[model samples]
Target: MNTFQLSCFLAVAEYLNFAQAAKQLHVTHPAVSQQIQSLEKELNVKLFQRTTRSVKLTDEGKVFLWDAKQIVAISDRAKKRFGGVAGGNIETLSIGCYNFPCMFLLADTLETLRTIRPELHPRLQEIPFQHIYRMLEEGDLDAVVGFKESANVKINALYKEVAKVPMVCICSGSHSLAGQKELRLCDIKEERFVLFVPPKGMLSIAQTQGQLMGERPPSEFYFCESAEAITVLVKAGYGISVLPDFLVPDTPLISRIPLKDVDQVSFGIYYKSLQGNPALKAFIQCAKENLTALDI
Candidate 1:
């Protein structure tokens, strides 16, 4: 099969839905289906089991997924290497960061990069949690700083867990639950909940929360675009929310309480190990140093 067919397969496999995969690849559903059909024909094996309601990988498809990822990773790395040589050497290292990390760690990382690697120009982009891996695989980003759990998609990348931050439940100071020392998932089940909704086809904050609460869905949900907005809404008495400890603002109008059972959020930097850019290497080193100094 060709790279195009392999890419289509990878996207479909990751998302397990042709429509979502097509949207991520910026192609139509029929085109994605055609590529998958062509690849299955070439390989003489059925990769996916499809039904009207759901799509799943066959035993053979699960085995091929790893090899397909390797092929795409190698191809992308080669293109980057040759493209750099043809374009007269790469000068700038492009880094991506999600909103939370962008607010908390980006400035320090940039400062460290400037002090240690003054010769290399760095370009930082504010990316959504869902787009980070795709941009890195497409060679548009050299490195990224984001929540570790958000990088669950299987891809060719290296992740260094620099910090672990606990998540806290937040509510207005006047809310009934604010004065409670300990908060449980069931306690907030009936409260109006403000949740962060990522871009289309990405894992959402609400889904994560559901998993945290043992698959017990929130009673009433309010979807928003960012954690900052959630904070604003919480303070305005709109709804309560759970946010990373670092993102919780020091506001008198809100109270941050501990949750009963939830995992700490792992925050860190991710980059493709196959990338041999000197600037990228230096940036990663500086990032680790800064993170350690900040004790995050």
Candidate 2:
């Protein structure tokens, strides 16, 4: 009928003595007897055969004992599992990021969280740039890392700039510009270009580069959705593109030239302003610490 009644039934069944069961449960003998009677009444079955000399289980009591034990065990486990929520002992921090930052920053942040709050579970979800703000506001994500300026200031979230990732020019190994150590916008203005379109309303690497170049657009614009795709096109000698330094994979077939005039993209962490989750705070702290080491 209830955990307390079931517990009393189990104690009596285990010892087969009302006085001993009461002693084991730290309750009075009459209290134990009352609970057993209540349970029998609730189930409409007698659980024990009692005599002046001794107490013994009914045939029904033996079968019901197993179910009672199982119910008690399950109740105990449920309490242990959910009891920590009020105490801040159990937490799962869901972090969102675009592909490149997910690859570069998520690992170090997870390691730090493991060391500091081993009880906290951390999840990393690769999200498109446009959906990040919506996810954070909707309680789907606890925190996110991406281009700092890309996050909408209109959203109710806190933003902390963690790193500045410089944009670099990538060209095929065979391209003439590949020989250059550094380049400016003027040098690549005439070269066919691959442009990355930011998801949603966020600014892409190409758009940022164009802002730095003033009224000049690329000689030819080839649009792609992701950094990886742009890299593939660049490697095939289709066009040159600008990308964050960390997004450039280590490959000899592609050459990365530093851009002198373009400002570095600011990467930051964003979390819902009102949800002061401890795990999110720890993750933000860990991210700031690992930014320099991650070289972003």
Candidate 3:
């Protein structure tokens, strides 16, 4: 019945968890639950089947999901159009990327963007890495924030390097390989490895193996969903992992040693083209100027 209700419905539909939806929307869990309840009541239909352990969409919910997305998209587009006219020519740049700690780095850049180009408003979405680049190509997203080595990037898209993030080997501070100035790929091969879920993660590992000339792969491997998750496992002594240096926490509990032979990933923005897009150009400049302050 309302944009707020529709937004809640879309978030819950995407994540299937009220808590996660609330987190994404920056609202309380009960607030999201209330919105869904109000929405379902207004529609005279049950949208989701709830359980203590899991949340699943009902049959009606499944049918309404696509419609809800379209409704929200249209509403957003209209707001941008009319809002721009009312504000005497404003621009909206829709950006998609994986979730934060990366966004943490972008916060300063976005603030700088505001100062430099107040007319340009950025709309950010935490899309899955698998679909992000494709959305950019499809024009659903104006830009993508990710690594250059990401398997999802295409040749046609232009890239602006924000930071060169080195690949580092991470382990518990008490681990045998800790206290080293740096490490070779072979040094960690015998240890159990923790990686992000593939195929992007696998491509990174393969690239590292090839470039670092690591002959033997780790005997055991663990796959995690996020770098934070991987770091948690590594700190618990579950396994060692290779990750962008910026992703590794500064805590003393973990040792982050640079990989001796691996190349740093070019982390930055990707867009189709900058032609006639002053907003995109200004954003790139702000990102380059501010993101370099990252202690790579």
Candidate 4:
């Protein structure tokens, strides 16, 4: 009936132990019991089955549990939206990012939200490129920065473009192959390779270069989900990899060499249609100013 009752109900239903739930909620055990009893009376249902030893939710309680959580979520979103109504505009922005590019902007972007966009808080999540599209469709994320061009992904092609940096073939600086003036696909056909698995098998700039020289995909691979993970393995002298120039950070063991024959992926912002929120115009303008996007 009220927020207090709903909060108490959730705590009790989740833990099924009045004492434990009370401790978690920082309320007295009797207060928890009374709240649940009051909620049961308000709803006109036996929400819980209680014994001296244990507690269990009734079927009705289980069904109502889901609705209770949504009620809280909607309440929170409403609070955020309501805050914007007071001053200028307050909206929550959730941005999904692929692992490779997130390292650069994640901290800085959030810091700006803390200072500049004091009203509109932004939440950042690391996600695979495929998950971004699905989340956008479900209205989970407000935007993403990814290389993929899919049907559902709407691109905001701002003035900045992701520069075409040659995909560099990375090897341990001490590895015998590292000394070569240039590398062709034939250089490492017999050697083990480390690769970051591409979403939808989108060939990276290096993979495209490998194809240009008629090289077969490596026989063995150490597949990595994150660029950071791939670089760690490469630093440990695992095997050669074709990685974006950005990922080759300041690591001592790894070295990058241009592949000479591949196109660079465009780096840009992707957001769902702004039909739901009319205030995206100002936010997009702020984004354009903040992002100093360039080739890696």
**Best-fitting candidate, measured by lDDT?**
3
lDDT of each: 0.77, 0.79, 0.82, 0.66
Q: Which residue pairs clash within candidate 3?
A: none
As a TM-score, model 1 comes out at: 0.58
Query: If ranked by TM-score, best first, what sequence of candidates would result?
Result: 2, 3, 1, 4
lDDT of 3 at 192: 78
Candidate 1 regions exceeding 4 Å error are: 1-91, 100-104, 150-152, 179-182, 198-208, 211-219, 292-296
- Scored by lDDT, model 4 comes in at 0.66
lDDT (Cα) of model 3: 0.82
* lDDT for residue 264 in candidate 4, whole number 0-100: 53
Better of 3 and 4 by TM-score: 3
lDDT of 3 by residue, 67-147 (tens): 899998999998887875575766899888776767677788889899878888799898886787788888888788877
Q: How high is the lDDT of residue 102 in model 4?
A: 43
lDDT of 2 by residue, 142-164 (tens): 88777665443476777887778
- Writing each residue's lDDT as its tens digit, candidate 4 over 208-271 gives 5345335455456677766677778877888777766665666767777766544555554666
At residue 192, what lDDT does model 2 achieve? 78
Quality of model 1 by C-alpha lDDT: 0.77
Q: What ranges in model 2 sit over 4 Å off?
A: 1-89, 100-103, 150-153, 198-201, 204-206, 209-219
Q: Ten consecutive residues with minimal summed lDDT in candidate 2?
A: 197-206
Report the error of model 3 at residue 199, Å. Answer: 0.6
